[model samples]
Target: MTITRRFPATLLALTLATPWSAWADRVYSDAQLHYVNFVQETDGMDALFRAMDEGNIHDVAIMGLGVAKKWEESAPKAPRYYMGDEAPVYYYSATDALLADAILERPAAQQARLHPFIAGFNPTDMNAVNHIRLMLDMHPGLWKGIGEILTRHDDLTALTKGETARANHPALMKVYELAAAENLPVILHSNITSKRERAPIYLEELVEAVGKNPDTTFIWAHAGTSAEIHRYQERVSGLHDIVSTLLAEHDNLYIDLSWTVLEPYLLDEGEPDEEWVALVKAYPGRFMIGSDLVGRFDSLASTIRSFDAFLNALPEDVADGVARTNMLALLPE
Candidate 1:
């Protein structure tokens, strides 16, 4: 399992190893479409899981749970839909919900479906819920009268941010250690509702808190795609940490351009920013290619086309990383 010194440098080796067609002058063909999925909602969770089990999708991350839930809950007479989706869940449904649904699912019933494992809960919500749960001395899905836990699965998120339940804190270091132990990469969905809210408290503090745990991976989702052409150009142009954290974090850390892929913003050279390409050149391997806010498998091609338009507009060195290799590095081979 030892990685050899054949790599001249971490960055350079990554650039060379990527496929050549990705760097061609014209846009990459619709065929590379094979590697991408435009996941919009969670309605087709069972079908997708079946697809994955059947090897129909091997390249995508289990990242888009909102899409699934929304589609399912909104769909006509959707069989297994959860009622009135209103949880501050982290990424997808929690590990417990997923297991519970599967074990209870009837072979032909929709009750068997589930979103992604990580619930992508807001850090604020995560902190808040942990606080309330501590006060109630309860876990998710606690019954009112019987005090029963709904699922049989053990709660991995049993640790608190600090010694006390109500302490204003982050479990950054703990997240790092657990990710390392479990060999699961970490994804932080920053670039939230506003650009200015992107600050010391959320992930940078979390990153500083975790410091360095070599095995852990941290991804800053969205990469401020909302920072349109002007803000990126005239105002907050020098924000390398936006780009740097993507580069400087642990080996498994990554950035996935989900919401950002749809942005119409641009610079004079028709680039998002020169730094995006430069960042890719700087750290190609530490990225995971994704396009969020999509609908169905049929709808993915359109999303891919949009993602390609943004990618093709970028300098070859940068777009290649975001489009491919960065995520491939994490394939659990």
Candidate 2:
């Protein structure tokens, strides 16, 4: 049976109240987003499409939540979010089916602009690659990419009720092999380091994965940053240097300028960072923008537009690519 929980009232209100036309005057493209939350719930595709049209988002790379936040008995009430309490979250393998069904239910016109990715398996399980293979076989033309795979996510990692996931996990390497064979790009959420770490301690794992999977396209989500990392103000020191070096070394690796990566790295207090600008200019094809919104469509436009300052800082062509075309280019024909 499919399980679901009610979205928090405050979040629902905020999502619905934000005017879609808030950015009607400016259209932006998103490279990473989720149509469902941790509990596998959304406001339906109708609302999402309306938001997309009104928000002027012409294309998007969307996926389902890989982990489902469980409402444990000890947590007096149900948790509305992944971090709502000490409740444990687990891999929801059925999420890929749900995502595929939702997209198949949509009209072809609507589906055209929506690039769906497979993301509902345990990355550490040896059988995880089997699940991915099965999903691909089950829905041959539906899946455009792989992942949003959770790895080394600080709070989520601690709360997750299973083996720890890492980019360099044996199972994930196999999955990468399959992705390369299938010509599907992979989006991975492996943090560069833990919150308190001063250096990019976990960088080697990601580097190893990217290095080994030369043929598999890997889009490092948030450029290896996360909300909790940003919230605690414990972002890895020398992140810019780390990212620059990775881009310089990895030809198959790409970075998404998601909401979490926008501040500090790409922009500081709404001002563009010259270092990041130089990096993007140096490798314009490897960068793209995303809202990182999960199950909330109202803020999609504003969140994507948040990158406007950094995008504006780039040359016109480079800005256009980061704002739109670059992500589309990643979709395999």
Candidate 3:
């Protein structure tokens, strides 16, 4: 028998209420929470810790420094022009030393258990690979994995002067090899298509990367879409099919359910979709949730709240795995 669960109306109402402390207590107080997609910022470590404390988010996989001012300045601005007046330009300062410094700055008791992802925009360059290795050497026990590597990212590529490095590019493959040797997973963002169409156009590159490096685990960030992309494009019906196929074929692949990218497909009228439910049940161990909060401390509570229903619909063990355990298993011991 297929069991279904729904988020209660009262809980939903409470989740939207301000002074998020109340919502946090109601939903997350007793839950063992671990957020997998925290983007590191030059500032805001203190505030991030404060929010994490309130939400009971104990551990985080923080991506590298996000502000690449030089690349942002040199890249074309056409892609973001459509974003309108309030479209803020995003920046990253994701370096190993900076991330280490940020974590160390936090008081010992307040610091969320940290798992760092070394960020790389262009992994095709040998220098980038060398830099990653050097970072690992310098910060002996700091890094847990490699990436949120902007592979096949259309918006970021435009902003970084059109550096369209695919997931299986030689340089990235070498990095994957290094990660495998070190027993670390690599999180990557490779969108399914550049056009607004619902097609898995560049999936082969991602598949090849996974196939060639069977030893290294790969976490597909946002299941290949972001809130911004979802806003502009029609929902892609084929996404679930692609994900299902990949999960069955690749033992090493995992999906990061982050932000609002997969919301429509995961839910119908605020309830879990039967098809999505079955898909998750079939591959229970392969999916994890992430806030994908890019240095926005205040958004943590709301981001976890957004996925409340989807997580609730899963089988109990599966929900727990996605909520905390799977990510914990992937982190460096």
Candidate 4:
């Protein structure tokens, strides 16, 4: 049976307002946190550490944005965001190095808290596998995982100005093979369906990726949901059924409870959803929390604290596992 409760607004507000790191009560390890923005700029190491301190986040699965939103010559004004202009977004390969450099700049203790994952490669490119190998060789011990590998993203797919990346792409297969060989976890973002499609058009592709590579630990980002997807359809009716079925079948698969998956699924109107609480409690080790905050520090505490309501509803041990240990357990020793 699933336990349910509405999180007290006053308690939540107080938790968000206070800094927990100093109290040594830092209870979270963000399973997914972006270190850089679309343009490859970060909140700076100092600011990031400060935010981490404030949020009581002990560790992070940090990575850079895979695609860079370009400023086209035709556009007179500079676009601040990816959606700000009509300029095409392209694969930015240097992102891995930028992330590596930032981590390297920090003190050894601070550096250990940031687990760098490589993004910034085109999943459709055949050479992408080689790039992954190269990053591992170059950094030696820095990389913990591979991805936010973009595949069948909503507007980003059309704006990407190249071949669409499907989860079952041959190039990505090789990448998965490499990750398996390296014993690294992969975080892939492949939308289950397009914005307007009622049926899950792209579900097969993701299933294919997971089924074919049983050795690879794959974290399906947001359980195949996106902000735009929810905007078009309030919810994917079959999401719960689909996820339960997949988890039962695939032991290597994990679901990332990023920002997108929180609403209309995990939490119902700010209270913990009983069904989702049951789903998570059923597979305690497979569900992990993530902020998915990109290049921002101000909201890190609030963003992570958002998971509290849902986490608090689960058994204490299960709640602790999802919030702290699950993602870190996936990383290399």
Please name the candidate that would achieve the greatest TM-score relative to the true structure: 4
Deviation in Å, model 4, residue 259 alpha carbon: 0.6
Give lDDT tens digits, candidate 4, residues 127-224.
Answer: 99999999998888788899989998888898997899999999999999999999999999999999999799999999999999999999999999
lDDT of 3 by residue, 185-280 (tens): 888888876646556788898999999999999998878765555666756657888899999999999988776544778887889888888998
Pick by lDDT: which candidate is best? 4
Worst 10 residues of 3 by lDDT: 29-38
Q: What TM-score number comes out for model 4?
A: 0.92
What are the TM-scores, per candidate, against the unseen true structure?
Answer: 0.51, 0.91, 0.80, 0.92
The list of candidate 3 runs beyond 4 A from truth reads: 1-43, 65-67, 70-94, 109-112
In candidate 2, the residue pairs with backbone N, CA or C atoms under 3 Å apart (3 or more residues apart, or in different chains) clash, namely none
What would the TM-score be for candidate 2 when compared with the true structure?
0.91
Residue 258, candidate 2: C-alpha displacement in angstroms: 0.3
What is the C-alpha local distance difference test score of each model? 0.37, 0.84, 0.66, 0.87
For model 1, the superposed segments whose C-alpha errors exceed 4 Å read 1-41, 45-58, 63-117, 120-172, 192-203, 209-212, 224-237, 249-252, 261-272, 294-298, 313-320
RMSD, one per candidate, in order: 11.9, 8.0, 9.5, 8.1
Say which prediction, candidate 1 or candidate 3, comes out ahead on TM-score. 3
Q: Encode model 2's per-residue lDDT on 1-333: one tens digit a residue.
A: 121211245753453333323434545668988989988888778888888877678788999999999988777888889989888899998888888888888766677778889999999999999998899788777788998888999999999987899999999999999999999999999998888775778899999999999999999998888877777764657888888899989999999889788887898778998999999999988999988778878887678777888888887667777887678777876
